[model samples]
Target: MADAQATGPILQLQGVQTHIGPYHILHGVSFEVPRGGVTMLLGRNGAGKTTTLRTIMGLWRASAGTVTFDGTDITRHSTPAIAQAGIAYVPENMSVFSDLTVAENMRLAARTGAIDERRLDWVFRMFPALKTFWHQRAGVLSGGQKQMLSVARAIIEPRQLLIVDEPTKGLAPAIIQNMIHVFRELKQTEVSILLVEQNFHMAKSVGDTVAVMDDGRTVHTGAMAALAEDDTLQQKLLGLSLAAHQ
Candidate 1:
């Protein structure tokens, strides 16, 4: 992984607590996504990883504490305003417009209301299936293709930070490799990424830093390679051998 580029976190959550309706989900959740790298948020199912992503995006109001993006407090910002600040979120549900063509979906994600030719070309290069399916309705795409479209939509406009929830969900091994390649390339552009992923291999392969979450709180933080190399730590924190999880 490249040396850390920024002096501070591109995304920071401090003592953030969230309550969804009657359920108290996040209990003072806190972590940071370092600048210029992929920060993997790993945990077992129901660990509040998805809730954390939603809180960061203002999809869920934090009952306490803060979410700071690029040094600006965004805990109370509207979703659109938060997005305007250059944070793009790709949720597990993907949220692609089923009725819209792939091209239309990309257009909607662009701040200018139209895709930039150069940027579109760049993304198409990374995910050629997207360009091949450009005129097709998003509803018809396979699971992997839909995931690709979700990512493509998030980057239709240049963003300072990108937050994704379980991007490899339901993807085959080949698709996971492709996603890793796309992320590795994106890292070089210096657009920091915060990923919630359960696939241990995917996390280790693409992450520069990692945070382990359990029951809505971060339990460990360290370099990805360190986590990958420590089998005992993996068993202790993740409850399985990292190799076995893959």
Candidate 2:
């Protein structure tokens, strides 16, 4: 893993606390996604993993602490403001415009006047399947294709950070493998990813660092290699024993 302090983190969430109505979800969550690494947010269901991503995107406001992106405090920014600030979010639902074609979806994601040809080429390169389905309506696409499209659209703008929520959630084994390959290819780029994933194998395959959340708080933070070795830590935090994988 890279030294977070030396290269500087593209996104940093410090002591963030969030609540929905009277239900407190996140408590003092703090972590950093360095300039060019995938930081996996790992936890069981209802551990505030998705909420944390929402908070970063300003979909859910944090009652305390700050969300810093590219060294700027964007804790209180709006969703549009956060997006304009170079942070992209792909929610659990893979929010693609169902009525639109794949190309049209990409066009809508282009904030700038002219579309980014370089980013378009890169996205197509990463997922050639997308290029083949460019004219097809997003609603008819497969689960994996929609996920790819969602991620591709998010990266169309020059984003410094990407918050992906449960990307592998409901994907088939083969689709999950392909998605993992896509994430690996994305990691080779300059974008920093904050991946909220319950798929431990997928997370382990692509993540540079992993943070385990339990009961609305971060309970463990370490390199992927270290976490892969500690069966006790895996079971305690994620309720899954990685002993079989070992």
TM-scores, each model vs. reference = 0.96, 0.93
Which digits, one per residue and each the tens of the lDDT, describe model 1 over residues 1-246?
Answer: 123324678999999999999999999888888889899999878888999999999999999999988878999999999999989999999879999999899888887797789999999999999989999999999999999999999987889999999999989999999999999999999699999998888998899999888898889988999999999999888888888867
Enumerate residue pairs that collide in model 2. Answer: none
- CA lDDT, every model vs. true structure: 0.91, 0.86
How much is 102 displaced in model 2, in angstroms?
0.7
Candidate 1 lDDT (Cα, 0 to 1): 0.91
Regions more than 4 Å wrong, model 1: 1-6
- Give the number of the best model, judged by TM-score: 1
lDDT of 2 by residue, 46-118 (tens): 8889899899989999999999888779999999999888888999999999999999999988875467787
Query: How big is the positional error of residue 206 in model 1, measured in Å on the Cα after superposition?
Result: 0.4
Model 1 per-residue lDDT at 12 = 90
Name the top lDDT candidate. 1
